[model samples]
Target: MERKEYYAVIFTSKRTDGDNGYGKMAERMEELAGQQPGFIGIESARDANLGITVSYWESLEAIKHWKENSAHQTAQKLGKSSWYEDYFVRICKVERDYGMNE
Candidate 1:
C-alpha cells in the first residue's frame, strides 16, 4: 500500500510561570507519539518564554488521534494551566521539501 503524506503540525507556545514540568511532559509525549503507527519524527525548541514543536505524521487521522490521546490530553491541559500562557498550532503540507547535509 502506498503511504499517504500529510502536513507537518507546527506548534508554538509561550510559557507561563510554572513551566518546569513542560520539558518532561513534552519529552514523554514525543516518545509516546513516536511509538504510534503513523508518527514520523519531531523537533522542538525553546527560548526565554517561547516553545516551538514540529511533528511529522502520515495522516491527519494520526494527528487527531494523538490530540485525543489521554496522556497527551492531560499534558495539553497542564500546558494551559501551568506551562503555556498561549499557543498556536499550524498544519502545512509539504508540497515540495528538500534538504542537504552540511
Candidate 2:
C-alpha cells in the first residue's frame, strides 16, 4: 500500500530489574494497541536493559485515544511504579519516507 503523512510515537526506556510481569504486559499492550482505531503499525527493539518501541498512527487524535485507554493507563502506572527505571516519549510527524522494496 502507498503511504502518506502520519505520526510516529517513539518510546525509549530502561528497564528496572526482573520481569515482574513486564514481558506479559508488553505483549498485551501490543495486542491491545493493534485493535485500536487509526493504529498503523509498531516496531520494537530491546537490548539488555534498554528498549525502544515506535508505534505509527494515522493522527494525533488517535494517539490521544490510545494514551487515554484504561488498559494502557494501567500499563503506564505499572511502568512508572515497577517496570521502567526511566523513559522518554517523542512524537514526530512523518512527512516523507523511502525504503527498498521487498
Highest lDDT: give the candidate number.
2
How well is each residue in 1-102 modelled by candidate 1, as lDDT tens digits? 233556699999888876477768877998999998778889888888778899998888888888999999999888877887799999887665555741
Clashes within 3 Å, all models in order: 0, 0
lDDT for predicted candidate 2 compared with the true structure? 0.96
Candidate 2 residue-wise lDDT at 39: 100
Poorest 10 consecutive residues by lDDT, candidate 1: 93-102
Model 2 residue runs over 4 Å out of place are none
lDDT tens readout by residue for model 2, 19-99: 999999999999999999999999999999789999999999999999999999999999999999999999999998777
Candidate 1 yields a Cα-based lDDT of 0.83
Among these predictions, the greatest TM-score belongs to 2
* TM-score to true structure, per model: 0.87, 0.96
